[model samples]
Target: MERPTRAWVLHPDIRGDDRRRAPEPALEEATALAAALPGLAILGSEVVRLPRPHPGLLFGTGKIEELGAVFAAEEVELVLIDGPVTPVQQRNLEREWKLKILDRTGLILEIFSDRARTREGVLQVEMAALSYQRTRLVRAWTHLERQRGGLGFVGGPGETQIEADRRAIDEQLVRLRRQLAKVEKTRALHRAARAKVPFPIVALVGYTNAGKSTLFNRLTGAEVMAKDMLFATLDPTMRRVDLPTSDEVILSDTVGFVSDLPTELVAAFRATLEEVTAADLILHVRDVSHPETEGQAAEVRTILASLGVGPETPQIEVWNKIDRLDAEARAIWQARAARAEPHVAMLSAVSGDGLDAFLTQLSQALRGPESDETIHLAYPEGRALAWLHNEGVVRAERTGETGWDVDVRWTARQKARFDAL
Candidate 1:
């Protein structure tokens, strides 16, 4: 493989900024973001304290010159800023440091562009990139059409004016949305088909790198791309899983949330996250071992709220990665889980230690007063057979010259619908 581009991360901690987070953790997250994009080697990262931003340069002259020297000596080819960078600031910094600069939004858009797999995902990323591109003060995000990969932020060409770019971007966005709509319509048909099924949907959501995919894989036996990187799973993956209660459910692992997620992405990926909204139960998987776990959880809740996931939706907070904690720390987190409001389950998805309890709790949470029921129908009663199949309650079906013998298990509610049929 070609040598990875050397990159540095800088978190500008503006004084008295209510939105600011713990500088250290923010820097760490930023470093992870940079490393997430393939072919980028993180040389180093730092927290740059600023009483006030320089508006035009984003940093003082002395600090710029100082960092520039370090960049030159270290041979860093790229700099990833942990927050927004205006077009002017980006241009000035790139010239001052003589290295390509990528703001947090730019970096994330690049990763989404790189990681999106499905046709809809690719279109969503393209639309988001274009939306982000249309706002540039200097250079826009690399032309996504280049398909040159990774948003080409490191060395993108074709910098243009907004008025001209706006027209082009608007047109491209219209085309992309049209394509996305067709893809979404297909997805909607699939979802409609699934709606006819009796299986409840359980969605896993949390901060990126919080081990959701790990938990999802352990429960569903699907090899989704689980990694120690940010935004590891961009598109939602779903699998049919039978819980401990023998209750089959549609388990969905969705792209994880992040602090200060690019607004463009939040809006663009809304449809991708629709699974969470329509779920019967949501598993809010959390990395309980991180020093800033609470903050991360808060961010997840904020984003969920934005998506209109109201209190009416039942949710269980899955405190994950307890395996990373010490005995004492583990006890404290376990205690917290025991008493947490709503529902909380403690487990290490990596280790099988607490999985059984989690599964048992999951089953109980979805439990209902339902029992086995068998229905016999003739081949002429195809409508009833289709209903049973559509309801996903068919356990076994035997076809005879006269009719079909069908075994089904359903709740009173579902059975009522079958009775009506």
Candidate 2:
């Protein structure tokens, strides 16, 4: 097998920026991002402090030369910058260092390029990639281990970079959008069909590698990609989870959120998150053991709000990955979680701890108004009676002269569906 391309990562911590994140944690996350790509080996990473970005080279001349010398001495072939790099900066940095350089947006696009599987996913990724390259078409993007020309950053052998001309890129975008529209229409139909079902949708969303997929797999017994890798699962996967309360919900494991997600990819992937908007409840999972967990959770909330999720959708905080925490930290989190009660549940998805309470809380949160009613149904309405029994809501029943008197306790949603029937 071909050796993984050696790479170095840098997170520029600009001074006097009120919104600046903790640089070390940011560098750690950026390193993880670099590690997520299959063909990249993160040799080292650093937080590069800067007074301000230079117009052409991003970093000052002295710093640029210093970094170039460092990369050369370490045999680094690629320098992955953790923040935005202007087209000119990318070009200049590459020219000076004699190494390929990828900004955060380009790196993410490459990861998505590697992970996207479904036809819709592939098309959306292609369109987003084209839009990204449209701005910097003069330079050849460093394709990875494939040894192909052009934007082969993540594709396999025989895959070639495409569409150099502005008109050509626009035409490709139009084609991809058209194909995606068909896929989306089919998805809408499937969603409409799912809506006819009485189950509630509970979407699992959190920062990438926050154990969303692990929790999902534990709850639903389906193996989704639960590796300790960023963006482990790109497409959303759903499974019917039968809660201990005897209630069932369609649990959706969506693409994970991340700090500073690229704008192009966010727009491309927005439609995939429609399941979230239509959900009855959102499970905001978190990696409680991580040092930057609070900031990560805040970022997830910000993204959710930006996606137009409002107060109408109820959300529960799932503090996951307690197995990775020390005893003292775990005790503190447990107590903190107790005070938050149903709204927050601290658990370890891998160890199956605290999941039961979390599920019970989930059932309560999703429970609509309960109605107690005695309904009269004729013998011909046996199917409706069976449905009530199947739902485990039947309390008592008595045969009458022409039909049956049924005592059932169910939620408002269940009542409505039965009424429609």
Candidate 3:
């Protein structure tokens, strides 16, 4: 039950000389996005590069006509524009190309629509899509009943007609928002439970397809969606990553950030983003082999800043995908990371190279002051045992003559509890 596939690329050469000059990165990003839909049978894809940007249509008349010809020749069923398209422009493009039109926002929405796993994720996607559709009501709409009542009169023939499409979209928006609020409450409850566990959260965030899920799976030994495709992981997946010292910490893999993410999508996904904002540490994973890694990193930073996870946050730069790079490139990256101490580490999540070093660093950062005391308490005093379970890692436990014999490493606050007993 897979949908029919049709794809096209429109890297609108926007007016800014510096901005338009970065075509290679856009192509690379698009390639990653295309790879995400491996199951879809893409007939063909053509990159439509405009000579210059046009605010209304994004591309010039000549370029649009030229694309129209190519679409006809290829029998393309969809046009994927890299830039945002206005309602008028989208309608015109659909009519001329005789296909469904999708800009970057729509494309991202489509991906989210397919990848959303949890109930909250699905609700978020639906809300975003509905909001987007509300704006496009002018382009394709239905006939509506007209009302022609006088200013003081209650009844008469209808003169003005309400836009059917707009009314429908508004109604849908209200319903979607109500559903999302319910889902938010459920997520809040789950988050509260995690907070009580006393485990610090570490969230993995980066540009799309940066191997966040792969690294997450390796660290936590849990299978998440990891692939060589943009947005391979959508819903935020959390698991307990066991540290070398036998300490368990909550690790989360979140939706990857992309350049120019639609505002609607961001607003909808705010609940999932709570993981990032609440994180005690942030791992910004980057694909070191990508030539445009710097630009990608900038994009991720921009999105994070918008989410309020600013520069002050405790961030660890994870230079991932090292296995794809040559020895010289690897050396260069290693040097770069060294110069950026307290913020960087180079590793290949796929091959498991340099993971131990990364993990050692991660554990040390998460660890607090060492403990000296060992205490034993009775089974009936289970509240104390539960408190110890959360405050520190339990090293050993056994039943003794009087009570439970326990050996553990705890913080000063937790060690003080023993004196209270």
> What is every candidate's alpha-carbon RMSD to the true fold?
6.0, 4.8, 7.2
Over 308-416, each residue of candidate 1 has an lDDT whose tens digit, in order, gives: 9999888999999988999999988877777783399888999977899888888767654678977789888899889888767899999887999888888775786
- Compared with the true structure, what per-residue lDDT tens digits does model 3 show for residues 142-165? 322221110111112221323554
lDDT of each: 0.86, 0.86, 0.75
Question: What tens-digit string does per-residue lDDT give for candidate 2 at 1-421?
Answer: 9999999999999998676899998999999989999988889999999998887889999988888888989999999999888666766787899888888888888989899988888988898888776655434334211221125433232214433354677898998899999999999999999988878999999999999999999999998999999999898899998988888899999998998887878889988888888899999999998999999999999999988999889899999989899999998998998898778988889999887888888999998668899999999999999999988889999998899999999888788778878
Model 1 quality (TM-score): 0.86
- Model 3: lDDT equals 0.75
Model 1 Cα displacement at 290 (Å)? 0.3
Error of 3 at 216 (Å): 1.0
- Return the lDDT, model 2, position 48: 90
Query: Sorted by TM-score, highest first, which candidate order results?
Result: 2, 1, 3
Candidate 2 differs from the real structure by a C-alpha RMSD in angstroms, to one decimal, of 4.8
Q: Give me the runs in candidate 1 sitting further than 4 Å from their true place.
A: 137-161, 368-421
TM-score of 2: 0.91
Q: What RMSD value applies to candidate 1?
A: 6.0
- Candidate 3: minimum summed lDDT over ten consecutive residues — where? 147-156
- Candidates in order, TM-scores: namely 0.86, 0.91, 0.81
